[model samples]
Target: MMLSFFDQFMSPTLMGIPLIALAIALPWVLYPTPTTRWLNNRVLTLQSWFINRFTQQLLLPINQGGHKWATIFVSLMIFLLTINILGLLPHTFTPTTQLSLNMGLAVPLWLATVIIGMRNQPTHALGHLLPEGTPTPLIPVLIIIETISLFIRPLALGVRLTANLTAGHLLIQLIATAAFVLAPMMPTVAILTTSILFLLTLLEVAVAMIQAYVFVLLLSLYLQENV
Candidate 1:
C-alpha cells in the first residue's frame, strides 16, 4: 500500500522542529549575549572596522543607546541559510518551503521598508511612492499602478521562495519515492534514479543559498533606495 500525506505528518520527527528552534535560540535566550559583541568580536572573526562599517548605517537609538540592526540582519540571514541548507539531509525538509514561514520573514522586511523610508525622508517618501512628473490626465492611473506594484513586492518575495523551494523539494521526494517503489522489481533502475536524486538534492542546497542571498540583497537595496 502507498503512503498518504497524513502518514508523513504522523511521524515523531515533526516534534523535532520546535526542539531545533529551542536549540538555536538558546544562546540568545539563556546566555543572552549582545549580538554585536558576539558576532562582531568572535562569531566569524570579523574585524572591528568591518563590523563598525556595516553597523553604523543601521544603528537604532534605544534606551541603551545605538543597537546594531546590522548584526541582527546578519543573524537572520545566517539562521535562514542554515535552515535551508540543512534540509538536504535524507530525513529532513526545508521549512522555508512553507508559505507561512517564508511570509513571516518577508512581511517584516516589507513593513520595515516603509517605516524606514518614512523615518528617513518624511515628505520625500510620499513623493517616492509614485513616480515623478505624472501627466495630469493620467495621474490617477499612474498612482493605481505604482501602488499595486509596491504592495506586490513582498508578495512576490514570498512566492519566489515558497514556490521554488517547495517545488524542488517535492521533485526530489517524488524521485526518491519512485526509486524505493521500484527497487525490488528493477534494482538497476532504482539505483540510477536514487543516485541522480541525491545529486539533485545537493544542487538544491546551492539553490537555497542563492535564493537567500537574493532576498537579503533586495531587502538591503530597498533600504538604501528609500532611505
Candidate 2:
C-alpha cells in the first residue's frame, strides 16, 4: 500500500500512546539551560542573544502596558520556531500543520487580547465595530461587516499557520518523490531536480521560521490594540 504524502503530517503513535506530547516537549529539552557561571558557553550566549533581540523587536511596536506580554511572545516564538524547524527533518511530524493544534493555540491567545481590550477600554473596543465618518445609510452595513471581520481574526490566524506549513511540506514531499523516481532512469534530470529540491528545502526552512514569527507578531499586534 502506498502512503499519502500527507501521512507525514499525521500525529505519530507508539502502541496506544500518541507522541505529540513528546514532540511538543522536545524543544524545551533541546535548548541549553543557562548556568550560574559568569562566563556562558557559546550556545547559551547565542540563545540569550537571540531571545533578547527577538523580545526587543517584538515589544517595540507594543505599548508600555503591553510590555507585560514580552515573556509569552518570546516563549511562544521559540516554541513554534523549534517545532517548525525540527519537523523538516526526516521522520518528524509538524504539529502546526494540523488545524486543530493551530486553532488550539490561536483562539485562546486571540481571545485574551480581545477580552483585554474590551475590559480595559470598553468604549474604544466597541467603537472599532463602527468607524467614524460613516454615512448614515451605510452605518448598519459597515458595522455588520466589521463585526464579522473581528470574529474571523482567530480563524485567520489558525488557518494561516496551518496552510503555510502544510503547503510547504506537501511541495517538499512531491518534489523529493520526483527526484527519487527519476534518479535511476534519468540521471541528468534527477540531478537537476535534486538541485531544485535543495533550494526548495532552504526556502522551506525560512518559511518555517517566518511563519512562526508572524504568528507571534500578530498576537502582539492584537495585544497592542488592547493595551
Candidate 3:
C-alpha cells in the first residue's frame, strides 16, 4: 500500500503506545546537567553563554516583576530548541507538528501571563480591552475587536509554529521523493534536485531553531505587556 505524505505528521505509535510523550520527555535527557565545578568544557561553556544571552534579550523589555520568569522561559527555550532540532533527524517524529501538542504548550503559558496581569493589575489588564481616547460610538466595536485579538494570541502562537514546521517538513519530503524517483531515470537531474534538497535542509534547520525562538519571544512580549 502506498503511504500518504501527510502520514508523517501523525503521532507515531509503537506496540499500541504513543511515542509523543516519550518524544517530549526525551529532550530533557539530552540536556547536559551542570556539575559542581568552577571549570567546564567548551561545549558546556558555549551552552551557558547562549542561554545567558537569550535570557538577557528576552527579559530586557519586561519589568522586574516579570524577571521571575527567567528560569521558566529559559527552560522553555531549550526544550523547544532541542525537540525542533531533533525532529530533523531521520526516523524521528516531530511532536510540535501536531496542533494539539502545540496548543497544549501555548495556551497554558499564554493564560498564565493573562492571569498574572489580572491578578496583579486588574485595572491595567482589563484596560487592554479598550484603548484611551476612544470615540463614544466606536467603543463597543473596538472593545469587541480588541477582546477577539487578545484571545487570538494563543491560537496564533500554536498555529504559527505548527504551520511553519509542517510546511517545511512537507517541502523536504516532497523534494526527497522527487530526487529518489529521478535518480535512475535521470541521474543528472536527480543530482541537481539532491543539491537543492541539501540547501533546503539547511534552511529548514535554521527555521527549526528560529521558529522555536520566535515562539518563546512572542510569549515574553505578551508577558511584558501584562507585567
Instruction: After the best TM-score superposition of candidate 3, give how far the Cα of residue 79 lies from its true spot, in angstroms.
Output: 0.8
Cα displacement (Å) at residue 10, model 3: 1.4
Error of 1 at 51 (Å): 8.8
Instruction: Give the per-residue lDDT of model 3 (tens digit) for 66-96.
Output: 9999999999889888998899998899999
RMSD of each: 5.9, 0.9, 0.9
**Cα misplacement distance, residue 98 of candidate 1 (Å):** 2.3
Give the Cα lDDT of each candidate: 0.67, 0.92, 0.94
In order of lDDT, best first, we have 3, 2, 1
TM-score, every prediction: 0.73, 0.97, 0.98
Model 2: C-alpha RMSD to truth?
Answer: 0.9
Window of ten residues with lowest summed lDDT in model 3: 28-37
Which residues of candidate 1, in runs, are more than 4 Å off?
Answer: 5-68
**What TM-score does candidate 3 reach?**
0.98
lDDT of 2 by residue, 86-122 (tens): 9899978888888999999999999999999999999
Q: lDDT score, residue 135, model 3? A: 94
